[model samples]
Target: MPAIGTLVDSFDDNAVDAVLWVDSYGTYSETGGRARVACTDGYSAYASAAAYTLAGSSIYVRVYPPAAGGAATAAYGQVSLLSAVAGTELGVQVNAVSGVLRCQSNVGYWDAAAVEVAYDPVAHAYVRVSEAAGSLVWATSPDGSVWTTRRTLATPGWVTSSTTVQVRLEAHRDSGTADYAEFDNVNTLPASPSGYAARKAGLFLGFF
Candidate 1:
């Protein structure tokens, strides 16, 4: 089993992981102690890095929506955890749009909707996902201390012991207007608040 612990990237060092821009105009960079994505062409861009396995993991990040620009059309950013890095991977996309956090988990070629959370773009929001109960749990917090549960889903088939996962920061715009999103305090923990240690222990025991 993967070691149980916590790993975090605060982005205060002005650094980011490998960047993949879906549009030539899209760019990823670190500015003002945060990882930022500028989708100049209104296309999509993902700044990603390999993260801890999900078997007993809780991933956390703070996301800020794009600043006002362009058509004011649909422009958003997301915190994603996926079984793989490719487009074909099965995982969850936690997208923040219109002051709300929306979740979509893909299974094979289908998309499953999870619950939504009230989020304010003007103010940064703390987002988290945990796999402590052998399933996926989504939550959000205003101050990082009090987290509100959003949704839960059965573990996707692609998320298995042998398959690895990644934490990704994504930005996209519907029009060719300059907009950017920021990400901060990206983290992966071995457990969540309650019952995680025991839950993880049972999962580890199951492999024997």
Candidate 2:
């Protein structure tokens, strides 16, 4: 198997790393080797890292979603790739109540596709977004070794042209008692030699 690259955090220190994350909202902390985000009624909790260029790289996170049966009508945990411009992002979210997994993109407008498979802590735990040659791929995994591609999109010009993009982890609940989501094994993989060649080849392929 290929080695995982560019570890962002394992949360083993029991503290959020300020050097690696910023622009946090609500409660975010490291607990028992996981990054935990507090999900309260009417509010969202999140943190972001704006350290990587979008091309030729991939970002991943393992999410343990919150359970259902609460007063909350809407609750979910998400991992997102955000362009430098606000309101432009690609994200995957797992619904807490229905366990639905939604993959969405926003480049001035929101478009989404969903997977009917409910999230299982052991069987469906990972989400990833990869960029190569002006395209973005979204996928999910059970153990990070095998991945299921969920969506593929032409990279928005705002993203492909940006010098850097952000990776965000977020959790939210609406009109309910407080709950939380756990995030772990945050990491990134740099582009390989073949990926660079693909990018070069894409120059002549014409985007959608």
Best by TM-score: 2
For all candidates in order, the CA lDDT equals 0.60, 0.71
For model 1, residues 1-208, the per-residue Cα lDDT tens digits are 3421254667666655434222223577778988787745455445344544766677677778774355345567776665653553333233333555676675453465645555554333777777765687777777666777777878665554623565567777666457688777766322344588778888889999
Model 2, 53-103: lDDT tens digits are: 666667788888766537446688888777776777778888887668877
TM-score for candidate 2, residues paired by index:
0.79
Instruction: Show model 2 residue runs off by greater than 4 Å.
Output: 1-7, 44-46, 69-72, 112-117, 188-208
Residue 138 local lDDT, model 2 = 81
Cα RMSD for predicted model 1: 11.7
**lDDT value, candidate 2, whole model:** 0.71
